[model samples]
Target: MLIVFGLMIAGGALLGGEGDSADNKSDTSAATKSGSSSDSKLKDNYHVGSVANHKGYKFKVNKVTYYDGSDFDKPKKGNRYVICNVTIKNDTDKKQSYNPMDFQLNANGNSTNMMEILTKENYSQNTLDSGDLDPGASVTGNLIGQANKNANLKLEYQPSVWNDETVKVSLY
Candidate 1:
């Protein structure tokens, strides 16, 4: 009877140890899969009219328009203006500065940035006020990007230019 009891204890310990090792392997694989998906989520684009809260500001994409550049005076030989109208709200009590320069327009596999230099008409009608954002203040305007055509478009906005954290808003 004592021998049988000893055998039972030894078998139980061995089986328990193997089960733990299997659980650990599964846990590791699960964590790895989640980690990979989370990285892609960071670059994922929020839908139009969806609000994204990052750091202290709230951002939303209102509308997108494709122009011949005749209205904005930013037309190249073949390039056109894919203007994204976005609303940025400051939720924090303190003032903040938002430069639309860091954001980019992603269409399919193509990408374009907010042009730093713009003609008076394009700059005035579409540019956001980059001044100190007052508490509870919100500014809405167009962000111009030169694109061949608007297709599967999204706006990639980085609340902090220094970090990889970005919120993408669908423009189409």
Candidate 2:
């Protein structure tokens, strides 16, 4: 009886040890697979908009239309600031909320002096509201600034949540 009990205990330990190693190997492989696929997925879905490198951030450009400021019922001028209409899309499958204050404007790869006009805080005072964006839904906004000669503007938006990803937009 003693011999049988000892043999059973030894066999149980060997089987248990082998099972743990197998589990570890499976976990490592799963992690590796997930990491590799993540990059490819990012590149595939990156087609929602165009990207332009600006000050280390990727600015996603949606539309570039010259606005005489009359669209907002403001005075129209011959040499008024060009309002770059942009639609920032959430490429991730998760919901994203955007605060316009998180964005900065740039023209010809240089930061513009129109930071206040581009931020949400300047647009609305006393309202700390962040516009909710559904997965794959885009939030539309405008960057008001003087148009440089042959300007190529880049609009930068950085969401507080999720890994920091820049959407680049180039306007000619």
Candidate 3:
């Protein structure tokens, strides 16, 4: 009876190890409700001009431009306007919604929401707006935000409003 009990325990331990290994493997591809583990580890950081995929949309930051606020539309006391020229492509089978509010500028560990600076003549015509995009279509526009005057910035894209998953794009 003692030998039989030992074998049973050993068998249970082996099975438990297998289950743990399977869970670790799934961690690399599984989408967690809080946040994606593989996504945060691998696909989170992107450089300018590099494409990042989230959900079914492909996003790329073509360029980043900083501007001093005009007299009429000045940034908050210690902030400057950041304009990101980005292109988002819908790669899914159905239509997707794109909005400027989905993008956030991070600087000095603070997240800055996108601002609509339509008063800027240069960006007024090319400003990014909220709309639904059809599959196979792409939209390019400038997403504006306010950041610290001398802070390093990272642009973060939140693909879904319901989920907290975000992809970070390095602006500099």
Best by TM-score: 3
lDDT of 2 at 39: 51
Which pairs clash inside model 1? none
After superposition on all C-alphas, the RMSD of every candidate to the true structure, in Å, is 8.5, 9.8, 6.3
Q: Give the total clashing residue pairs for model 1.
A: 0
Pick by lDDT: which candidate is best? 3
Taken over the whole model, the C-alpha lDDT of each candidate is 0.73, 0.53, 0.83
**Cα deviation of 37 in candidate 1 (Å)?**
18
Candidate 1: tens digits of C-alpha lDDT, residues 1-172:
9999999999999999999999999999999986765643443568888877654578888877677655557566667677778888888877877877768887786777875345666545667646667889888887877766636777888766225677877766
Whose TM-score is higher: candidate 2's or candidate 3's?
Answer: 3
Q: Against the hidden reference, what TM-scores do the models get? A: 0.62, 0.46, 0.71
Clashes by residue pair, model 2 = 58-167, 58-168, 59-167, 59-168, 59-169, 60-167, 60-168, 60-169, 61-168, 61-169
Model 1 per-residue lDDT at 6: 100
| Tens-place lDDT digits, model 3, residues 1-172 | 9999999999999999999999987885564643643452337589999987755578899999888788788888998888899999998888888888888899978997876575978877788888988989999999888887889899988877225668798888
Model 1: residue 144 alpha-carbon error in angstroms: 0.8
Arranged by lDDT, best first: 3, 1, 2
lDDT of 2 by residue, 1-172 (tens): 9999999999999999999999999999999986775653323122325653322223354555454443453422434455555555666666667675665556667765333232334332322235776766665665555545455565555556525655444445
